[model samples]
Target chain A: MTEEGQSEIFQKMWSRKGFRAELRAASAIAIKQWKVELSYPLSVLWFIIMPFIWFIPYLIAGTALTGSSESIHLQDLTGISDWLSYIAIGTAFTGLALSLLWGSGFALRREQNVGTLETLMTTPMNRETLVWGSTLHNLQHGGLGVILQLGASVLIFGVSLNVWGILPALAIIGLSIIAMQGVIFAVVCIVLTAKQGWMIVEFLSSILMLVAPMTYPIAVLPPILQYVSVASPLTWTVEGFRGFLMYGLAYEGVITAVIALIILDVIFVIVGTLLFRATERLVRQRGALSQF
Target chain B: MTETIQEPSTKSVESDMAYLTDFKPRIMDWSAARVFATKNLKIAIRYPANFLVWGVLPILWFAPFILMATAIAGPSTSTHFTNISGFDDFVQFSVIGWFVFMYLDNSIWGIGNNFRWEQFSGTLEPLFTAPVPRISILLGAAFSDSIQGTLQAIIMLIFAMFLFGVEYAITAIFPTVLILLIMVFALYGFGFMVAGLILVFKDPSVLTQLIAESTYMLSPIQYPVQALPKSVQAIAYVIPTTIGIITVREIAINGTMSLPAFVQSIGALGFLALIFWGLGMLSFKWAEKWTKERGHMGGF
Candidate 1:
């Protein structure tokens, strides 16, 4: 095709000229994922139950250490007296962080394993549609999983949460989710380029969990490590989520976290898209795109 | 022409199995197990990555908790931990659990996954058909995993001693070993049970993961069993590791084992191991027959 024709096509597909097709492409990918995942009903159930699995370690730790969830010393460190509720909220949010870390990248890899990656890559669809679809699929499962995890933790374990803070917490979480999308795109770029295995996934997830106070309160980390935590969007998300929903801290305190998350969102979108696009172009040039 | 092409492979396999079956063992059947143990050790040495991660990842897993405990209690640490655990050090308390947790993980998840890994690599069937007693292969696998895990555990223990200032006692080693032998025997049975289930179900990844997480809760790996609810502690008591861990912790911290507790735990561990190993053998036999009837042994 001529250069002019290529420009016109790109504009049409990405810009307002071809918005409808882009939406349709994304929706189709999401539907395909939903169908494929739901076929493995056991796997779906496992994911839904995953947060409960994640919670047990900390729950046991709290019980074993203090013989109760409330820790006066921990409260001095983190401003939360009830460790159970705090951990419940933290685990709920960490699910989002982990799903974003693992889900987006694995979607592409899973396709390659099933012999659909080549077709998906070569199809006449906007590239953004794939990212959008992956995000949609992860959020569908991850969001529902978090809600159920938190709900069960509350009902069964009696984790006391400030129910009224739901809307404000969700808005802050929205910013965090957008930031995570960028972060996941960058991760997918590495996956596509390096062809590393699950250990790399483990390394990445572990690093993110370490930097973020997802389970452990960030206050407990040394000042240097606490400073480093700011590098991850999850740190902001966890702080904001806890401050709003669990601690019932004033919204003013959480505003700082919200602002920090939005800044991360912007940086991640810019850097992540560039990194992803660069990796995509390199793979196309090298024709490694066809190989898993 | 077809018979000529197929005859050699059929004869070769028959001869191999016949050789394995014909070999007579002395009263001590240690030589057969030695053969497998050596094979397992070679594999561990050659592709140490699978085994090395067990050593490395536990330190990484344990580090955060240690840091957190230090942060929470600071210089003096949790009085509750010292009072309940009989040790004033929270850092040592959690690290002890982490170390025990690593050993249990190596036995249960590591050895159990060996079954799944063999299937995925298309080696399970041939191994099963080998004329050697199937028990030898499992015994060898369990032994190798434990040896590899022991190396990791030592490294972790040293790291914990240095990093957390844990009091290392030479005298505790003898008793710790005594506890570990019984503990490992029971864990091998648990591993065999998992391997048997995977043979039947073909996918116990989720089930194993659940067991892994639940075991952390039920085993008192990170917390004392007494701290849990009475009902939960009752459940925890049934798990062999829970008893083994409590016994070892007592020995390690206080330099003495509770005699009655040790005896009770050892007896329980022996009974559980025998029951689980028996069930594992039966399950394998049933699964082998079922798969042969269906011709799905080779179809992972």
Candidate 2:
């Protein structure tokens, strides 16, 4: 509480070495959470199993449904006979989006409920580091779900892919998740004030699922809904992944989607950080952080 | 001699024990089933935002798709699609089908996962302590969601009527309403089953998503079920939504429901409703027991 101690804290905040230390600390925390999530076998099974079950039947049905039609083909949509691959990608991205939103958004509330939020905050680790660590933890948890679903799509549906293009598709997926995390963090700020984060979670999960271009293409959506889909990062990620993996990277649209994702990520991070900082200050002054 | 030795204090204590033994739960409160239903209704009205998100939002969501499909397929396409069900306008078919499915999905997923919100809000355990059965709590939540879904569906149907310029026939109104009622109960039974899973698993997101996404493919929403392969068609008949969608479409577009079709569709839905409702109740009871034993009724 003394001036000398405050000065030391300020000094620690500013140094290059201190910044690196914070990043390392955040990474460690993120990794630890990811490990804990991996320990849940049922969670892993649910993520992978359900998508395969749904998508495989659809793939088989799709072939029969479209057998007479010449316009849409396996080669035309995603270079796979199994429409399950397309559905698989949609399912995977959805899992990722849901995880990012729920995981990071709920982290603080969970910690607070467990009576650990204050203790964690009291530690010397910077708030930014904690936020980053939580976001990373979410990404890893969600990313694993997506990967498992994708793998199941391949195995069960017999859907073949270029395989090499998966890396870029993953990068795009990561960026999309990061962008979504920003929006979720802002919502978390509102949640902190209202103490209605769970309602927000319910609303977001159900609403977003309908609005986003997850199950069907944007083409299936009306003009207005199409715009709504475009506004969501998940739509672009779905389209971009479809373009890169299914279309053999021939579509120039993937570039635009990737660029959009990057911009969204940067904007979201800045906005999330600002909202978090403002909320943190309000909580500190009002002593509301521990209220829940 | 013993009777003569009895004190007033002992007599009072004996009376108190008799009072405790004779006490019975009031008949009105014994069931308390409506409490769960009422609680859900109250929550829905109290939180209009949740209603809008789960109920009204789906209408908004499918609005765009409906408009474009109508624009591309033309108003007459309804006649073509309806020949299967007998309704003349495809828009009417879509309006009824989408709204019904939307409500069903919202109620099922909403009630199933209601615990997550309660868990996060730190109210799950306190709620469990109440004498009211947990089923009532879930039913209350489901009722709220269903009301929202119903309202949204009505509004969407009205909007579609105006937007697509489809005429409503009074003759078919009774059938349509009847079908809606059947769909509602059938879906509720299924929703409760999903809710039961949530009780057991603590997270129903995965199961909910699998069912939700797959339903769109299985149901005859955008296209006729006959468009699906024979194998897939067999599977589709097993799902209540398929019959629900077809029945709604039949009344909306075809203007007549055949005896055989009605019997088959209603029978299929009745069977499914019975199965899901039984499973849901059983699972819920098991979950209640498990939670009590494990002390995780409160913990997320």
Candidate 3:
């Protein structure tokens, strides 16, 4: 290209609100994360492999507790003798939820640990874009993991599928992720400020796994836990996915869930953004961006 | 900071003799292990809340299974489970499985990731030059991990029994404790292997996570091994936790601990520990050599 033409392209790229520049920036951050991750090949292999293996506990628990492929209580609770499918769906969403919780939640902490957080923050690019890039990378990997595991589960344990229901299920999961991001933004802010928050991550991961009926019905929990479980957006996400893919809820029920999810998304995003901004301002005021 | 015999300028005659005597690595050095173990415990105690949480929060991992068991059979009795697996109290069965797994989980993860911590702190190279036997370092780390893990496992077991209204007998507890010690031996061997891997490969938290999850799945941590598919069962047997968990749960759930089975499992665990420990030592040495050659010991 001529110098004039190149300059024009560069100017357009430099302009704010330009889709091309935003895309390139996000892509760069994603690629950077991938390269850093791939630098440790053993971890890369595990990242690709562990997401599927994460379900073994639920599967083992289901089989061992019920002692068969069929469960009378599971049948009574969800009206399905196909406990394997029920468990698979729960496990799949749980992995996705995990992606949101750890994958995105700790992205900034990772950058900080690598000594790159301050550098990224000082760049001309927006910080949220970096977060979005990291989150999408995690989500993409996580979503693919759930899909691959779901396929294997269908073949190995014989989970029933309406392949067509995947679109709607994906839609519901997509909406749920938006809601999750709001909550995660708050978590990310706190993690960025806290000291070596790995314990916090583990605590959240285990707590979320237990609180949400990812593999079992929420009704099984104590009365107090039941209320707490229902309050999680993932409860609705898993329930909606189960209803859509497993039990086939009516259209009205699906619409009601979608609306509820939308409301949650708005509330979470607003509160989350506010919390993050407050933390960010405090961090800047104290000149602590480079400290952590 | 003690000098080797080769460094005559820095080595006094008495120190040289001490170094020479320890250099052969024929005699075990309990002191070295104690030092490293104390150092590790001190580092851990730096963040007491974090240390405490790791012991307590693992109980949360057990919560879902208990909740699920309650969902399946209403927390009272499991008729189908009894018919097939010879146990009615599924909560007791699951609690025992997860409880035993705690030792394996803590040992494997703690020992493996200890290398990463050393790397991150920029001290792995000095550690390599320490005159103490490498195995002692592994044992020292494993020693502290076992303390925390064993405490947590007991806490989890008690919490589980109380929550599920399950009861344990002295008969079951005695044999289960024995089995747990054997399992810890085997797990340390595996931990050494992983630590060796981390020593060379650098921080592989994802790999450790994978190993932990795979261990949980294949070991019948929340279920009976019989529930796994035939192929998975064959694979599961290769992991020492599978046998250990099954044996431990058999004691708790049946309330009739079998001596022969317990003794046999202990033997199997010892065999695994021997193989893994040997391999782990060799791997750590190899990884140390690899890192020193590459000058990447501090390259996390």
Q: Which residue runs does candidate 1 get wrong by more than 4 Å? A: A1-20, A67-69, A247-249, A290-292, B1-37, B49-52, B64-76
User: For all the candidates, what are their Cα RMSDs to the real structure?
Assistant: 4.9, 7.3, 4.3
Error of 2 at B177 (Å): 3.0
Model 1, span A181-216: residue lDDT tens: 787887788788877656766777776788787667
What is the model-wide C-alpha lDDT for candidate 3? 0.76
The backbone clash count of each candidate, in order, is 1, 12, 0
List the candidate numbers ranked by DockQ, top first.
Answer: 3, 1, 2
Could you tell me how far off, in angstroms, the CA of residue B30 lies in candidate 2 after the best superposition? 8.8
Residue-wise C-alpha lDDT for candidate 2, range B1-300, written one tens digit per residue: 455665679789999899778866442342355665666567667766654444445555555445333333333453334454344555666676775577666756777777777776788888777655566666666666666677767766666677667665566778767776766776766777776677567775656766776777777765667667678888887667778777766766666778888777777777877876677777777777877798777665
- Quote the RMSD, in angstroms, for model 3: 4.3
> Tens digits of per-residue lDDT for model 3 on B1-300?
997666555458779888787767534679888888899888877876754576577678777767767666566567666666667667667677777778888877888777778877888778877877888888888988887777667777777677767776666777777777777887888888888778776766666777777777788766666778788888888787888888877776667766787678888888887887777778877887887789887886
Q: Least accurate stretch of 10 residues (summed lDDT) in model 1 chain B?
A: B67-76
What is the fnat value (0 to 1) for candidate 3?
0.80
TM-score of each: 0.87, 0.72, 0.89
Candidate 1, residues B201-223, lDDT tens digits: the string is 67767777777777876776656
lDDT of candidates 1 onward, in order: 0.75, 0.66, 0.76
lDDT tens digits by residue: candidate 2, A1-292 = 9999999988875563576788887788798776766687755666556545544433433333333212243334333344445555766676567766777777777778769888988877887677678777777766776777777667765656666677778777767767776777776787677775676666666656656655455555558866766677777787787666765656568778988788878887788878988988898899998896
Q: Is candidate 2 or candidate 3 better by lDDT?
A: 3
